[model samples]
Target chain A: MNVHEPERRLVTLSDVARAAGVGESTVSRVLRNQGSFSKRTQDRVAEAVARLGYVPNRLAGMLAGSGSTAGAKLVGIIIPSLTNIVFPDLLRGANAALDHDGFQSVIGVSDYDPEREEALIGALLSWRPAGLIVTGLEHTAGAVARLRASGIRIVEMIDTDGDGLDIVVGFSNRGVGCDSARHLLARGYRRIGYVGHDITRDLRAAKRLAGFRETLREAGHPLAETEIAPGPSSAAAGRAALGRLLARRPDLHAVYFSNDDMALGGYFHCLAEGVAVPGRLALFGFNALDIAAAMPQPLTTIRTPRLEIGAVAVERLAADGPAETVDLGYELIAGATA
Target chain B: MNVHEPERRLVTLSDVARAAGVGESTVSRVLRNQGSFSKRTQDRVAEAVARLGYVPNRLAGMLAGSGSTAGAKLVGIIIPSLTNIVFPDLLRGANAALDHDGFQSVIGVSDYDPEREEALIGALLSWRPAGLIVTGLEHTAGAVARLRASGIRIVEMIDTDGDGLDIVVGFSNRGVGCDSARHLLARGYRRIGYVGHDITRDLRAAKRLAGFRETLREAGHPLAETEIAPGPSSAAAGRAALGRLLARRPDLHAVYFSNDDMALGGYFHCLAEGVAVPGRLALFGFNALDIAAAMPQPLTTIRTPRLEIGAVAVERLAADGPAETVDLGYELIAGATA
Candidate 1:
């Protein structure tokens, strides 16, 4: 029961070799599952490893400096928040791709804090990961300097609005906003309102809002009302925001939410409040999340290439190509809500 | 632009020391921000590091055998799936806890595959993480052996149905099922049915189902019907499964779903099909997710302490105590649905 001793002696590769009655190199080969080793010798080494409890220090192997294992088979990934389904979706894609290529991910959640992101970047960098994938282009000057000087393959994902430190794989957030506004406009819904979570922390949302307002202004129909929830996006916040927005601007014909989570809340609000979606009040959202489609009346939203961005970021990192931006693009889902 | 040179020379601590006109020890001390070092020396080392792109290898530092950095400030966390918000919420809790303790997490997704879990365990083990956190108590023999032999702390989370390898932190899934069934029975709903996703992969769900069935049989009601979707739990799958369950046995007075995601789907189905919930058919679910509370008719479900389980697991790992099971009990939310 007392498993947590202060300092238990670690089992070494030499211990495995000694137990197996084989050379240290043979034990190493069997443990790495690399180099030439006979089946009998492999079985012996495995038995010794299990018996001796030899957990190989892969860091030592990397320090030994074989060409293939020169860099640790690890990728450092920093995302804004895990609460939003979007980041998880991105991580799922990146993890799958990295796993396929025999790499593991060390993850840090920044919680939309620039200073935290910088600290996470430095912590992750100390591990000497093969590559680093960060969420956005916006970073503190300290973070940017550290990333630029790290000399590892760096990938900035989920937004393609500005210059990137290295490889950038994502669609334009502003474009998604502009397209969403156009879709709502095409549906002949004017006097549009906006309901969203905190945009200050979510720079992408801020960009989208800018583009949306710009498009609406050009059309001579500016946003009628805006309700910005104080914290991270949630269905409850979305519902309450929609309620508050509706109470303030009852004449608004349509509502554009920051993302699908907020929009789902808006839809639920409509359902609970006896407001006919699209008939009484049109609703539009971003990120065509699965739940968005599963709703009784599907939510009209912009489907960003979240998974593709993560996957392609890893792919580009592994490919080790030139520093360039790859715009995977986005799609507009014209569901019943709009 | 051509960052992908085949053999880019790596900057070393020695190079930083040479550039800064300081000893390698001073550079190391400055990089770690540990030990006694002058502010001027720290500035010099930082300037040199920035100039030479020197990424201090923390692994190498650990190998050098400093007690403070003896074991890497890393914890390996392996979860089943990322698509399910439950896992993210758990990860968020664990990550927050780990981050607070100055540890980063290396994550792997087993995708509910035992073989994959074994592989991921082996992979994570090579990193020599300070501790390991895996989703369930049920693991392959290989994984169990490796975990037992690893000698470091291991925390198995989110289910307490069976014995764990080390520290176990979670509520009993079977107990959740029993309580849910009892709640429905108390609400005067007989002719009950069950709808779930592939329980063959999700062992916890299988345990819950077994408990639900046993409790129902004890009450002399028994399960009226059952419908299981072929893949992972999803809103779409849940909605379709509920629809199919209803079509097969319209006389069923109540239904229990795998979790809140499925329950939400069923709720949406009721909304779409105009099935009067708790009037004609009562719906019960597990895992009182935030969305479950946000629903118009709040879902009747068990609120498992997911965040608490994760945080407690990390706390137990850090505490380095005796191997023990910590049962953070679940709460039965008596909502409007059941």
Candidate 2:
């Protein structure tokens, strides 16, 4: 409830200093564990603040554009889904940094929808965040307009292939895709197909697919058949799509999926139908999610640096002036299935 | 920035009604769309609201008791984690209902920690939500005490097994677990084990495990070995946990997982390691998430009514008279895995 009855004026650093019989700088130093201060003075300041129930205003710099304030410190983060593990990891990292700095994060969920990204840019602008971090470079007309118009610092995350907004942080989806294709192809897999869901929504997946296709084309071979589900990729859709694809082309030797979720489904389909993985057909996926490697044979995939992107974004946002992009890169994980 | 500069008073619903030359009741009805009104009158009300930039305060009832004219309706939502899909589905449903009522949802992530729940409840109380929808009935002493003291309406969601706070809306996790056990038993699988991730933190998963064990014990057999990952359930952890379990006890014929994520992991493991599902080992999981059914050999799972639970909680809050518990119920899906 935003009950407008004026709250009692909070005890400020000045009040704490006066109560402690010390200078404001001395009180600040003791609280921040920075400059050397007498033990007695530190205890006095601590006691004064506790007695006054003084919660520090952390966002001083952000709100005033000067001095140190915890609440005003900016922390930027980008995630594929607010409702997914990838986002949670990002949150964990950003939260750690932001909370430490007395900064809070304003997040936007892309929903894997580029149009929504454009809309979110406007929503985030109201807060006048010190910095901005977004999922990828793929943006709708409205999103690009606001991102360009909004003067706040920016960090583009997850995929670092395209032109950045201001600060770019993440790995290359296309490179990960190419690596996956080469690994599977080297295993004597020629009749390779692809199964994915809503590559149109997930620009990163589309990039990976493009890279995979480029690698296949260079090898003088084209993808045998591709199956795509209508909406967000899920294990069930992956299984259903793969089942249909295999039903149409039963002799397919290998298949590279958009992500581990789809590849997991394809694996399940093989498990159910008595078609051995890597024996009759090889399977590969991206985002070496925990389950991918945990699988019996392990999923050969790429591990994106989700949490680091968040942590680094916040770190950069809290630094000096104007923004810049940073690419953290990704890792190639070789599991049993590939 | 919490600027202290003076500004004109915000336009209220009464002003819009006056400006539109309509009765106050008429404005309320039109805004809520609860009663029948002529198109001409509706258009007038809409025009006046737009012209004045009137933001409706859905806190009419609560504001009557408070002294200030500046209060926003608080819709408090406490979820275990945003990482899982189930909670997101619930959140989306709640958001749809709350948005229409001009109520903003303030969320607290408990991270499956009861202590965190206690802390979050304390923080949420400061906002003074008109209603609170918390996940599950189990809570720490401090949390329960604070909630009881708040006197606001409370809704315990995602399970209806234990004593509720004020209102409870969810299905029975125990029933879901038992039914899964029964389904596997009916499929003639004798040797069974349980695979899950951190049941200690997730009370609902623990309930499911309890029911599964109880049913198995009633059926004249006990679990072979329960394998649990030390973290949140995921396909990767499920795969790893299943692999380790299998290596320890290769003769097990079936395994019941805490939820779909873990089950998916186990399924992937089967594909990677050349384990035959159903033939060599059957897999069962809870929460028939989208991917569960899409797998090539669909997984046998208990489908939870997630969206319904969320929507019903909001509906109960909007009714706003007394509180009670609701058991929405769950569905058992028989897929090829079992």
Candidate 3:
């Protein structure tokens, strides 16, 4: 990447006006996308600007807008993983609300690293966004301090197990896990096992596992086996993890997965090995992704309020209402898989 | 969502400095992430700023920097969809490269709508980003014009069939389709079918289909059946489309999918129906996503350089390289399924 070269004469509005044969105000009106201009004029101005490589100084124009110091109408959203459909779905919902409000989201991906999250927080805070939305409550100490130090409205989304920095919206991960365990146990599945990806990175999954195990222990029917892949969860990893688990404990009646991605992997494994689903090895997962229901035998899982959490989070952020934690709950789906 | 209220009193640096019991220069140094300052002093300033709700005017600080007119170190990345792993993969790769360069990506999702792309272009350009990266060359005319007029470095990624508005980094979609057709034909499967989502929305898929047909015509073999889902492509849609195709023309020895997503759907359909993959029905797809390899019978598909396109596009943009198109071609994976 090349660094900025030595100073050169900057292109001004007058340069664009001279090039387009229009006044400075006409160039400003056309470039800002505010005032109306003739199609021919817009085209001519656009062509001239392109040819001259003229950049409009938005900072100057923004400050010049109607005698107000409103910082950019921007919001910052930081997510853990883009690979997971959950985050994308949340983003989709958030964008719907944000777009309607005429606010643009500036996004950052943490890739589930706390240090990266902190760095992104510092960078985003530097922009002084109107509001910031982040995935989970868990953050590095620096991130927490920086967020608290930044006066922008903050929304901690997707998890509610911990105290939020500001407005919190989402279901409890532990509750979803506890409900999943009870649902499976009520269906007469003892000798349960677990198949998932790394727990250290995915704190929400860890909470789920904790709740699942707690429920099992209370029922005097503890987990029989567990296969934890030391990486991010994928269908293949889930399938491989289940293979390892079943190879060791073939008598395992059922298995819980980190999420639908892992469960789908297990489901594929069952199909490949000719292990009759539910009758042979019942499968359960969280985040009832679309593929889960469309499976040959629909997957029995927990449907977390992913889209709603995002939409409502944006709504609250835009509202600038009194800060509060909102627990949008999850639902259990009884499908043919379990 | 509440509308912005009338203009109010603005918080100044002097206010922050006074509240922190420090000089304005000390506060500015800590806020700018520049000059040496003790942790205690930084904390004191950050606390005061948050308490006083002071927004540092980035525009003024930016202008205060050495006489370079570089806008905020931000790049705008606009994608087609977040639902498809393709875009997420692209984003992940782009973020990795951009983060390494100390640049941040502000993303917008178009969801394959040209109008949305145009609107997002206008909105993103309003930020006066240092550069902009968009998914494909086929954009609304206004979008193309605005992007050209914005005078920021532009990188058009993932497709290279059309004249780019700026630096283009991707292979030909038509070439990929033609190659996919040839791969299946060489494997001795002639009675081929096609399944996809809406062709009108995704111009790239339409280009692929056009190339596939051109190749098939050149081979003296045309598609036996075609199933194009009205909505976005998904595994379920793939299954339904294949089911429809088989119900009409059971003689289809092989099927070409729009991408791996639809192919995975077909793969799942074959699994559920007890049809032996590659024996009873052959499957081929584009974009060799990770799940395709994890399948019991790995899917035969074209591995597009999605990650490379994203990473290299950012590299080229950061380098401010001369305007030219870069073709980071595709690879054909001869997996077990085909």
Candidate 4:
């Protein structure tokens, strides 16, 4: 088997110019319709471009005009993972907002690695995007430095716990944790446990845990047990972690999961094990995903304004405004689970 | 509030050269670490670049060098939607492979609109990506024309039902539907229903349904009912659609969902409504998602090689092999639900 070479050579602007019997500058002017050109010249250029199949390089066009930094209609978005539905929801909102404003997104997944985030930031900045949207407030020093030096609008999303470099659009993760603890406590579940995934990489999850613990401690009922599953957060991991946590502390009356995915897993475990939800053991979660509500016993969770956050981030990037935090806030759902 | 202007002007290569007391070409050579340059000149250029906060214009560099096509380390990926976990899984695999080879991805979402797909194709091609990966074989005539004329490697993913412009890497959607129908038939289900999302936009689902219907007809037991939700597939939509379908055709023995998300919703519906799954009614779905297995009674579904398709597409794009179709087959997971 031989490697497939490019089927045909790319038709250059020069080719269009030659075919149209006009200078390259005239061809460019006619195509861009920026400078004064006759109707006949424009027609000739268009016909030549169509016939030659010349796709104008926007990158070069932007550079030749006002530089990519000023004219490139691109946004760079870096997220932790796509496996979790939360990130996709965020992208959906961002993409819709961007599409409306005629901008395209160049995306990078950091995989919860600081080094990777730094590398991705450098790679993305090379495109000279109009703005950069990164997940959370936490980033490597190198990554932060690049964002600051890029001289473009920077929007840090999904967390507002720390100071942002420029624009910050998200609710506080710690606040979600606190609200969850308060909800569980209000329901009179004292012996509460925690089930989560890797918090080191998912810093927001860590913040949530810290807030939950603090809220629980303040309520004079500290966490009874904690089971943190290794690796990324998933339904299987949540299910397995819940089983282990229950095995360790059978007396635990409630469990606060890191998010809906893990909480759904816990819910599944309860159904399989015949543990009566909100009777034998209560459950609370974060991010009220669509599935969370559709379950037999709807999950008692915090519904972060995921889509709104994404949309607002884009709006802020486009709007001429001072850099400020836009906390869309979160809603605590009193579902049957708790 | 005043709009946030660019905090500072971008430091150009001219600034670096001026600071380094050298020509712009000398500064470029030193920074790229290409061509001959004196050690002292390199040191001076590096110092000036650091002092001036100069970020290199990779777009300009690529255009000036071998043009963006041969030199740009970018791959344009246009997926249908981010809301569906299936697309993200595909992207996750594709991104991992691309990252390993030092390639970045510029992504656009078509939202299952043919016109939008055509527009995105035009936009992506303007970047002059080394290769382009678009979802599915079905595209508008304009989109197909653009892909054929682009001259770069093109990868059509997720469905192998039609002819491709260049490389095709996916399993047959019709086969998946056929196999699923057979699975239900072998399980002794006669009066089977299909709960799905909009088949018009989701052509893959349409293919699956057509294949299922054809297979069932050949076996002398045609489908009993079909409930198609109006919007994109989601757990909520699935659950709602299942309710509507069962309400209309309570005599149905088994139900096939378009994908796991919809099936999961159907599962939830059963749990909520006390419908005895696989006892009074059996359930089958496609895409063996993580949550599918963790459910109380695991969902009997087909596990499409989503990740492998994405990874293989990238590998083929990078590989020096003749353009060909790769059939990465799927698996049928016979879980407790069916």
lDDT of each: 0.88, 0.76, 0.85, 0.89
The candidate with the higher DockQ, 2 or 3, is 3
Per-residue alpha-carbon lDDT of candidate 2 for residues A1-338, written as tens digits (9 for 90 to 100): 11122553435678988888899889878876887988888899999976764534332313333222332344434456644456666766676666566565545555676765665565455445666777788777767656655445677777888887677778888888788788877888888999998877778889999999889888977888999988877777788889999999999999999888888788878877889888898898887767557666677788888778878877776664454557788887877777
Write one digit per residue (lDDT tens) for candidate 1, span A311-335: 9999998886889999999999999
* TM-score list, all predictions: 0.94, 0.75, 0.87, 0.93
Write down the TM-score for model 3.
0.87
lDDT of 3 by residue, A1-338 (tens): 11234434456778989989998899888976768899988998999987876656655654555233344567889999888888988998899898888777878899899999988886776565678999888998878877765656799998889898889999899998899999999999999999988899999999999999999999999988889988999989998999999999999999999999899889888877999899999999889887777767889999988878989999999887877899999999998888
Question: Which window of 10 residues has the lowest lDDT sum in candidate 2 chain A?
Answer: A59-68
- Order of candidate numbers by TM-score, starting with the best: 1, 4, 3, 2
Query: Against the true structure, whose TM-score is highest?
Result: 1
Off by over 4 Å in 4: A1-9, A13-51, A67-70, B1-9, B12-52, B67-70
Q: Per-residue lDDT for B120-163 in model 4, tens only?
A: 99999998887899999999998988987876789999999988
Model 4 Cα displacement at A336 (Å)?
A: 1.2
Of candidates 3 and 2, the better by lDDT? 3
True-structure RMSD, every candidate:
2.5, 7.7, 4.9, 2.9
**Per-residue lDDT of B37 in model 1:** 92
Clashes (candidate 3)? 0
Best by DockQ: 1
- Give the DockQ-based CAPRI class for model 4: medium
lDDT of 1 by residue, B1-338 (tens): 43545666668889999999999888877876778998899899889987786777777866665234445677889999999989998998898788788777788899999999998998888877888999988988889888877777899998889988878999899998888899899889999999999999999999999999999999999989999999998888889999999999999899999998898889889989999988988999888877778777888999988778888888898887888899999999988888
lDDT for residue B159 in candidate 2, whole number 0-100: 90
lDDT of 4 by residue, A197-263 (tens): 9999999999999999999999999999999999998898999999999999999999999889999
